[model samples]
Target: MSYPKDFLLNLYKTMVRIRNFEIMAEKLFLEGELPGFIHLYIGEEAIATGVIADLRKDDFITSTHRGHGHMIAKGANINRMMAELYGRTTGYCKGKGGSMHIADFSIGVLGANGVVGGGLPIAVGAGLGIKMKKTDQVVVAFFGDGASNTGAFHESLNFASIYKLPVIFVVENNKFASTATTKETTSIENISDRAVGYGIPGITIDGNDVITIYETAKEMIKRAREDGGPSLIEAKTYRIKGHFVGDPELYRDKKEVEEFWLNEPIRKFEKKLVEEKMLNETEKRKIWEDAQKEIEEAVTFAKESPVPNNEDALTDLFVNDSGYDY
Candidate 1:
């Protein structure tokens, strides 16, 4: 697929932003500067950056616990995201959602779920809403290999197919579900194989290759928008870091982690861009430097932001309050 320079530049920027943001978050969390448990999206950048790149502002996406990359890719504000991580009131969820629950409705990101496979049903519901309204908008659900075992994953796919909903189920298979490698959990060699049972088209791609992800996802996204029904795309990739900040790192071998970095998606993509003449070394450095600057600024914003006030704790519980009208 022929892509404009602007698109390529944006994709690279999004990936860089996510990588840097997660890196910064890991440091801050380790330093005890940021509150709560954190799940950094250091390795799964391409899956979100490529899949969501084709979506419009009106199109929706649901995310999992490892959702920072998805939110950043979908154009969620970095300052707000950082503030959420910092547990400040200026956050996207007013410090309530934290890392696993950031949501930006303006960009059609319903929210990120802390539960495994929580996003599948939400994406299916969004697709149902779009179908009921007769709009062409589509919904994309992002989940991990671990979540693929969930009942919601299977049930939602079946429902989407039965109702002919416009939805794309993207499984970012990083090969491990937390500590256990996928080989220890399931019998199927590929998660995409499950799609055949639901009568939906399925495709698998190298998740580390951003361009491959973009090309494969764009077709399915467009088809879903045109009412072609649901599709599942499995992206095979690896995470550079442990499940979350402070993971003991006992389950994985040290050499495996080192090799994952050697074949990291961001590093590989940068190399490809230079080889293809799409970008240069100087430009790549500048891109990374700019990303660092942006992350610093976002951190400053989140740090300066205020904490939620006591009064706000119960204010947004409902659209309207009813007390039997006295």
Candidate 2:
């Protein structure tokens, strides 16, 4: 697939933005500026950026606990996201939902679930909604390798396949489900192999390669929009960090972790772009600087934002007109 120069540059920029955002989040978390446990998407930027690039603004996406990249790639405002992390009132969820629970319905972000496989069924439901409405929009469910083992994953895929629902199950197989490696828990060599049971197309690719991810997602998304049944894409990627902030990471070797960082997707893609003469060093530097500035400004915004009022805790918590008991 031939990629336009501008499109390629934009992809690079998105990856950089995600990388820098996560880096800043990590720094803030360590400095006690941000609250809650954060599962940084430092190494998985390419998967979200590439998959979301093919999605329409109105198309729905269900995200995992490690979902900052997905939200950013889907065009969520970083300023509000930062405020949410800071537990400020100006956040996407009015500071009620932290990093793991951010949602922007205007951009079709269904919400990032804190549960391991929570988003699978939600994605299926959204797909059903789209089908019933007779819309061409599709839903993308972004989950980790650990989520594939959940009953929700199996049940949702089965349901979607039987009904020919327009949903794509994207498995961000980052090798580990928290502290446990997939090799320790999963029996199959490839998570994509499970798709055969559902009678849908399943394929595994280098999740770190943005170009490959973009092309593969484009095909599956196009197929889904054209009334094709659900598909499973297992992205074979690695998480450079521990499961969450402050994790001891004793389960994996330090040497192995260092090696993975050496081949970090963002750096690899930048090298490829420069080699292909699609991006110059000056442009790359400018991109990094711009991303850093944006993140700095977001942090400032979050810091200056007000905390949620104590009496308003239950404001948006309930759907009923009667409201909830305090």
TM-scores of all candidate predictions against the true structure: 0.97, 0.98
lDDT of each: 0.91, 0.94
Q: Residue by residue across 1-326, what tens digits does model 2's lDDT show? A: 26788999999999999999999999999998888999999888999999999999999999989999999999999999999999999999998999999999999999999999999999999999999999999999999999999999999999999999999999999999999999999989899999999999999999999989989999999999999879999998899999998899999999998999887889889889888889898998999999999999999999999998887686886677527764
lDDT agreement of model 1 with the native? 0.91
Best by lDDT: 2
lDDT of 1 by residue, 9-65 (tens): 889999999999999999999999988889988988999999988899899999989
Clash number by candidate, in order: 0, 0
Worst lDDT window (10 residues) for model 2? Answer: 317-326
Off by over 4 Å in 1: 322-326
Candidate with the greatest TM-score versus the true structure: 2
**Regions of candidate 2 where Cα sits further than 4 Å from its true position:** 320-322
